[model samples]
Target: MKKNLKRIAIVAMVALVIAACKKNQESAETAPQETVKNADKVLQYIKDLGFPASSIVDNGNEFVVEEDILFPKDMQIPAGGAGTKIEQYYTGSIVSATKKLNIRIFVDPSMTSMSSEINSAIAQWNGVPNSTLRFSIVTTAPYDILIKNEALAAPPGFVTCGQAQFPSGGSAGALVRINKTAIASNSFAQRARTICHEFGHCISFRHTNWAAQGESTATNVPGVTGTDALSLMNGGQCNSGATVLSQKDKDATAALY
Candidate 1:
């Protein structure tokens, strides 16, 4: 009788362990499915914003569209994602006025060599006449954005100088990755332009020449409509783009902020 009781007790213990293991396995499987579902949503949101499927590159964790704009897999999608209009275009979503007043940037150690360029870029935005948008570099924790050096991959016939995420949840986009080596040969002003351009993305600025780049459309800043030849926000020009914001760029900055 004693032996039978011991055997039964051991069997029950094994059953409980098996049940717990099964539960864990189920949870593990469910987690990836959820991740995939969220990624799909982000991909759809990118499509809704008028980025053609051909221009979108799935980089495992994010979508690199138009070569420079990055849509992270886990980013907060704006409610009812949709595209609007053109001319000095915006992403429809933007950094809130209050949050735009002082967007803090933290430079990672890898990007310390470009500190001057980063400051130069910040100065361009800060100098926007009558606009309250500002960016100050912070060395410690709790920052609104992070700028770091990354060896960005280059596609055939194109060199990616930098990449930036877009604004979400009422704040600036949180990440800016600069291909330090790729743009090392560029002049200081052009280097700053690269940084400045990526920062533009952080604050919700789209490529000013979105149409030319095959983007479906983008919402224009009020009263700032019309293509801008000197706009620093134009894509594809890379190291050859404008070194400073054009008059229309300032107008658009003021219009939004």
Candidate 2:
């Protein structure tokens, strides 16, 4: 009888342990209310931006894109595209002539700490002496509105999410919209890298298309060289797998500024 009782006790303890573990797991999986609400906002933004509807997949706390340029479930992207590089047609004259301009970052409610990060990014640009480009933050409406206004005077499709200036030396603007949930999910370095990458786009950079390691991807056309891993404009992983800016990016931006 004692043997039977001991066996029963062991089974009961095992069951209790399993139950406790499951409860702990459940708690761990549950995100804070703010995080969940923010994630929903990001999804709605993505939908408004016109990403492929089929790509949206809910993965618990955030939405994830499983194929063809994976995006986090919590990010709202108007257009999903990798970065690219373009030849600067207008040279020294235009670069020297373009005036210091203002750039406004329209923040979606989902972006938590964008203001501080943006200020720091602009300061980085300011460090370049004699560079005509200058930027300031404007929090108002759609960033695209500003892009459209600037685009009107720009080269034909010149101001893209890829590049900064038009061929004519006209100043363009970049608009950044970030997802806070996605930011927290990633390391700080990775998040910063992504911010810098987007900043590069505002300045008119293309994805690094340079070929190395036997990796050859088609650029827009035969003549155009796409950005590569070493190039800050490239869409590949950066910041030690976190997406930080490349040295090339600093050089390129410094050249402009």
Candidate 3:
């Protein structure tokens, strides 16, 4: 009788935990969307910026423009198509750098366990020749970037390897999501590369292969025009992408930062 009672207690506890998780998820889904003045006009504003209609996904609170940009539903549309609030002033253009050279990257509790991969990604950007841009891990308030792990399921449907929030207000975007579980089994180099790719986005890099990816247009770095087969900033390559920045990649970084 005691054994049976203990078994019942364990099952009850498990059910309670599952119920809590379901409630949390439900709250997230029902959270209020961003407050936009006009949904249709805001959408038109996005289209005016060169994003095709198909690339835009109405995600309730915001529009997922392209595979990376998150356009909040409540943002004030600029009088001109180009808005000061945008991370990148122009598509295919390098993102503007922060006022300070040492950019602070904070790993959330969920991502701290992957320190080796995080540091590896940081080293690549910090070692860029002739560039003042640098990335540092912080453990306190006022961080420039937050890298966090996200649980992503795959099987019957496809999900992106990771997502990055672009810099805004002249600083690095505050968030970078890493699908740790999905790529946790990748080689050390590949794991680092996945992170490296997302960091590149945080700084305003358009995929080098955007043209081939059906983006209507992508601007070339002033002097470094043309496709780079080994560019580390190529999107959709994920674990198979270039593990290090190519010569053109370095040139582009030097040109911009």
| Candidate 2 backbone clash number | 23
Q: How do the residues 138-236 of candidate 2 rate in per-residue lDDT, one tens digit apiece?
A: 567533212111111113533222112211123332334343443445665455555555555555444454234222232332233334355545544
lDDT of 3 by residue, 1-257 (tens): 99999999999999998898787775754333334445666688767656789898887766766565555565545445444322211233233455438788889999988899999999998888978888899899788888899864333555567777555445665578888877878899888988988888777676788777776455666677788879888877767889998888887777668
Estimate candidate 2's RMSD in Å.
16.5
**TM values, all candidates:** 0.87, 0.42, 0.74
Cα lDDT, all candidates: 0.89, 0.43, 0.72
* Least accurate 10 contiguous residues by lDDT in model 2: 145-154
Q: Indicate whether candidate 1 or candidate 2 has the larger lDDT.
A: 1
Model 1 misplaced stretches (Cα beyond 4 Å): 1-31, 83-87
Stretches of candidate 2 exceeding 4 Å from the true structure: 1-85, 88-100, 141-174, 209-231, 238-247
User: What's the true lDDT of residue 97 in model 3?
Assistant: 52
lDDT of 1 by residue, 1-257 (tens): 99999999999999998897788884667766677888898899888887788889999988898888898888887765754532378888888878998899999999999999999999999999989999999999889999999999888888999999999878899999999999999999999999999999999999888878777678778899878889999988877889999999999999888
Clashing pairs in 1: 85-218, 85-219
Q: Give the TM-score comparing model 1 with the true structure, all chains together.
A: 0.87
Best by TM-score: 1
Q: lDDT: which is higher, 2 or 3?
A: 3
User: Best candidate, lDDT-wise?
Assistant: 1
